[model samples]
Target: MVTKEVRLQSTVAGLTADGRVHTLSVWFILALRLMMGLAFFQSGLDKVLSGEFGAGGYLTGAVPDSGSPAADLFVAMGNTPWFVDFVNVAVPWGELLIGLGLLFGAFTRLAAFWGAFMMLLFYLGNWDVAHGYINGDFAYMLVFLSVAAFGAGRILGLDTYIEGYEIDGQPLVERYPWTRYILG
Candidate 1:
C-alpha cells in the first residue's frame, strides 16, 4: 500500500493509518486511464462496427500479401472457422466493452485483462509491423498489461468505492493473488 500526505493551510490536520496524508495524482491517473480505455475501446468498436470485422479480409491479407511476418502463424490459428469468425465479430465489441468499462471505472481489472489479451492477438497478427523495437502493437500490449496489473480504474472512479466496501480487507483479496487483479 502507498500513502500520500496533503497539508492544508488551516490548522486541521489528520493522518492515515500509515502516518501519511491520503493523496495521489488522481487527475494524472484518471487521464491515463481514460486515454488507455478510449484507445482500446475504439479499436474494438471499430472492428465490431465495421463490416470488415469477421469478414476474414484482414486475416487473409495477413499473409504474404499483407506483409505481416506472423501471417503464417495467424494462418495456423485461423484454421478453425470459429476462430476466424469469432475474431471478426468478437474483437471489436470486446474492445468497445472494455473501453466503456474502463471509462466508467467499472470492472476495470477485467477490462484491462481483455484489453491486454486483445493487444497480444494484435501483436501476433501484425508481427510484420514489428520493425525493430518500436512495434506499436507490442507497446499497446504492454500498456494493457500494466493497466491490468495496477487496477487503473480505482484511481478516480467507482472502483475505489467498490474496493473500500465490497472488497476491502476481504480474505479472498488478501489470500488470492488473482483477487487483487480484479477491479473490486
Candidate 2:
C-alpha cells in the first residue's frame, strides 16, 4: 500500500551528501582509524627495528630556535643521555600500544584520548608558528578527537561487543557503568 508521496519522501531523505543518515554511521571513521593506527604502528616499528636509531638527533632537532617557548626545555633535554634513552623507549612503546588499541578497537576512547594528548604534546613541542602556525600534528590531534567524539569504535570494533558485554548476574555495563565513558 505504498503511495507515490511516501516513495518520494523515502528517496528524498534517504541520504545526504555528508552521509548524516544516522549517528551510528561510521563507515568513514573506520577507514580513518585504520589509517591513523597503521601510521603510528609503522613509525614505532621502524624505530624499534632501526639499530642505529637514536633519539639524540631527533630531540636535538625538535628544539626550536629563540622564538619558541619550549626552546629551553628541548635544549636542556637534547644532549642528555638519560632523557634521550627514556624518550627512545617510551615513544616506541606508547606508539605501538596506542596504535594497536586503536586498530583493534580495544579501549578505543582511552586510546584516542591518549593519542590526542600525545599529538597535543607533539604540537606544542614542535610549535613553529614562525613559519605558518600550521602543523600536521595538530591536524592529527583533531582527527583523534573527532574519532573519539563520534564513538568510531562501535562501527567495526571490539567496543561494539564490549559496550553490550554482560556478566554472570548483571551486565558489565550495569556493574561498571563508567565503562560507557571509557570503552566507547
- The 10-residue segment with the lowest total lDDT in model 1: 15-24
Segments in model 1 whose C-alpha atoms lie over 4 Å from true places: 1-26, 63-69, 129-131, 165-178
Candidate 2's clash total is 0
Ten-residue region with minimum lDDT total, candidate 2: 3-12
lDDT of 1 by residue, 1-184 (tens): 8554654342335733333333554565577678888886787777766657563656666554656667776776567688777776777788888898888887888888887787776776666553574577778777777666556777767777665553455644454556566773
User: Which pairs clash (backbone N, Cα, C closer than 3 Å) in model 2?
Assistant: none
Query: Which portions of model 2 show Cα errors greater than 4 Å?
Result: 1-25, 76-83
lDDT of each: 0.69, 0.75
How many clashes in candidate 1?
4
For candidate 2, lDDT tens digit of each residue in 68-177?
67667776787788988887787887788878878988778888888898888777777777667677988999888877876777878988888787788676778898
TM-score, every prediction: 0.70, 0.75
